[model samples]
Target chain A: MTALAPAASPARTPLGSSIARTLRLGVLRAGYEIRVYFRQADAIFFTFLFPVLLFGIFSVAFSGQGNIGTAPDGSGGISQGAYYLPGMAAAGILLSGVQNLGVDIANERSDGTLKRLAGTPLPVVSYFLGKMGQVLVTGILQLALLIVIARVAFGVELPTDPAKWLTFAWVFLLGIGTSAVLGIAISRLPRRGKSATAVIIPIVLVLQFISGVYLSFTMLPVWLQDVANVFPLAWLAKGMRSVFLPESFASAEAGGAWQLGTVAVVLLLWLVVGIVVSRFTFRWIRKDS
Target chain B: MNNIALPDAVVSVRDLAKRYGAFEALRGVSFDIHRGETFALLGPNGAGKSTTIEILEGYRDRSSGAASVLGTDPQSGGLEWKSRLGIVLQSTGEQGDVTVRDQLAHFASLYPNPRGVDETIAAVGLADKARTRIRALSGGQRRRVDVALGIIGRPELLFLDEPTTGFDPEARQQFWSLVHQLKAEGTTILLTTHYLDEAAQLSDRAAVIAGGELVAIGAIDEIGGAEARVPLVRWTEGGTRHTERTRTPAGTVASLSARLGAEPTDLEIYRPSLEDIYLDLVRENAEAAAAEIDADGPTSPTTRPSATDPITEGASA
Candidate 1:
């Protein structure tokens, strides 16, 4: 061979095949990421175990108590244990999908992992898809684990109706999408690895409080409700409650309805905003923009 | 060499330029890497070595001029074109807690024809540490992991950007051996390094870039002109040291002894090292650029000497 060229060129797949190839490769990336996450005790604790612990605490503290907020005048309010089942589930999804995902990406950015991956022939979109896939899988598992704990430990009743499950499915999917997108978008906010927790924890805590995950929306002030309405967390928590709470609990909600259409619209808006913001601000390297 | 009139050039560039607003990162840089050749782009920080390499790697866009890698313009080179090349960045940024084998396998799936994960791990001398999480490995071993990933694709063209920057002397030697093995397998490598010794050891041809322009481009042994390959004559007289650069150092030493009518004290003749010539080239290029900026006004574009111009008169006195 001469000095410049290789004796044989690398094999190339056609453009049509690239998407299929990238998706297949993306699965492998997802598997690698999942395995790494499982091996880290800290990642597991925050993503899986912490949500279960929070669910137990809330369920016991609020057990058998009547809902304190805006239930319809004639109907008795739902028990606090039943009210918080979806609240903790929503918490788990947001914890893994938004807070954890954002911090993980920020750490990757600070450490140059993203830059190294960009250097390879790996389709750039596939890397993001893989990360989302990991969050999706972990978020679902966290939700399931919390549901089991809420049922077995606190004796909470699950919604058995097909219609209720349909609502749960849509709300869960949209919540994960909105939170994952938000995670990817806001990951760039933390300038360093050490500051990722500092930036993410406060935002999550505030979102949890204002969004009705910690306190029922009826208990919150109207001004705070307006502020929470602007963010995905409140809509997600409200949607989750609509799925798990008894139909009578709709009396406690605004407008005395589940507000499914508004939930879909609000969550969809957050998803779109996240995708747009991240497209412009995401960086592979640590260098200043 | 200035013409780069090669029939089988794998990478070819002509007057490539990149601009960021008012600042120019590369200005009229030109060169070619012939088939199967290990080429080095040697320069200091911000000398535009990385910018030139990044443009060739299709990671950044050039503001103007012609450039091609693997017979396609890097700006539009598709995934098919990209699959043929591999890159090892200056930093080893990998997913922590992943085993060496796992990371290599994941990258292998991105390529149509990749080396076996086990073989690649062995190739990088990480066989003993293959199962260990990357976070558990020492810094040098992690760098080996970076090299493994770069080659896992069995790429025709490999780019190593300052691959040995943080390596200890032994680790650096091990890396050099790995590169030599890749060369033996006919992999064409384009390496960028500020270490002249690294360029001298690994590259068949090297281009010295300074101030975003090519100062010299030729075979490593022949760059900076042939006279620069000469030896230095040294002597001490009256407890003072003196040295002279000359092509005929033996004759110069003989004349010095004859004139002094006594053996020059502590005399030694040594060949001018590639590092010496490289440093001289960089210093001269910086001065030339500084002078042009002063004469042409500070905001005027910096002018470069002709591509064919020798870096200096040479090491010869």
Candidate 2:
């Protein structure tokens, strides 16, 4: 038998010193997750790069000189290219944080990665927080890439006011919180690692089309508009539009307004509901059901 | 450090049972693993060995009774208590894309004090594969990675569930040595495997569990009983073979030789192997179950036996 060198004995410390330990361990776990996420070409392409590509496609297709919608000033027409910027940005956030996050969580649970971590001394909350931290980092990068594509390719104006940026920040945070929490909550439905994509992608695609990620919300039928309004995705798109679009586009919205209060309330409610449901529904490992 | 006296038991389980609705996975199983000892829980598939270990590891909840690991109840074991325990699961519980070194380093940070990541990689014989993605490694290499993660925490108690299932023979040898090194350093280990020879080779004591109950448990040689430890004598007489288990095998063989007026033809003496005892014990448990069903009516709800008796017979060749 080949013998390897023995490990040096670790110095003893009091047990359960988790306040400091949690932060240190959470950082390490987050770093590990980020490294692995970047290394997987498939994860990068589908979660981040796919959104950038979509941004380019949507911006170029809508860049025609023709004016198609009511301008923010209630003028006869608005630039179609400008109309798509926030829409694609909303889709990007939903794909990376909600849809992709669900698939990742499902894969991890079925693959026993979550189970292994559950057996360790690390806190369970730390595991989720660390993973969410990685998702937030990636989500920011994905959003940045989309914004860059919009400004460069479509001549979309950047938000000039600091208040608009503040609005953008809160909307982004609440949108990500709601979607990522829902992502974790929804992962309980997929029993197998391979089926996560099968279950999540189609739903994301349908939601994207219906909620105006692929087209203007006004183009959808009235019933579809009502259905879209009930879900957080539609409100996310509306919220993002409020941050990027001028004030007159509010008339195109369902209530003829951005409904910023409703956006915050609805997203916050979803976030809270997602957390509660996930606490009850999440399984560390597969069950026979 | 060489001769520090350790606790009487690092793991103490008593009357532990787990029930999933009406189906009972563990039926009041009990065992103890003293500090610095390699203990094996030997059983067949679905024998509740995994259930028992998992309960002790705090990965699953138990229905009744008590389990203590590192002097704390595993059910509510705090992080400090958890840090002292290492669990090597049967499945590959790692990201497929992470490099070996990175994975080990990440797990190392979870514990308060941990073995160096590079050293752990070498200890598990994964130095060559340290930079390889887990998905790119072979089955045996992944198993090594599992062990590396299990031991990186410098746990006082380690739980390994079928740790060598996919290992090649050489890798298995290396793993055995790694376990031995851990034992020499006074790490208490509780292992479960279907391999009887592994139990005999590595464990100071072993418990044979079958049908969610412990059929027998003791020192490897003396598990079945004193008679099982004794040798059996066999001889051929007039084209027929006769065999008898006896504590006084020497006297029995001498008397048989004298009666035959020479060495008996095809004379042989052998002690019952651990496998022999284990298989006999399992068979006895099954027969006992069948007998209980017979004694009780088919419609009887209490056909499951409340207690199992270990059979003393060791006729296995």
Best by TM-score: 2
Interface RMSD (C-alpha) of each candidate?
A: 11.1, 9.5
A90-200 per-residue lDDT for model 1 (tens digits)? 888888778887899888876768766666667766777777788888888888888887778777778899998898888988888888878888898887777999999
| Residue A74 in model 1: lDDT | 34
Output the number of the DockQ-best candidate. Answer: 2
**What are the TM-scores, per candidate, against the unseen true structure?**
0.85, 0.87
The CA lDDT of each predicted structure is 0.79, 0.79
**TM-score (2 decimals) of chain A in model 2:** 0.89
Residue-wise C-alpha lDDT for candidate 2, range A102-169, written one tens digit per residue: 89988887678887877788876576667777778888988887887677877777879999899999
Q: In model 1, which residue pairs have backbone atoms overlapping below 3 Å?
A: A2-B35, A3-B34, A3-B35, A3-B36, A3-B37, A4-B34, A4-B35, A4-B36, A5-B35, A5-B36
Error in Å for residue A141 of model 2: 1.6
Instruction: List residue ranges in candidate 1 displaced over 4 A.
Output: A1-16, A60-79, A160-163, A188-203, A223-227, A265-289, B1-7, B20-22, B92-95, B252-264, B289-317
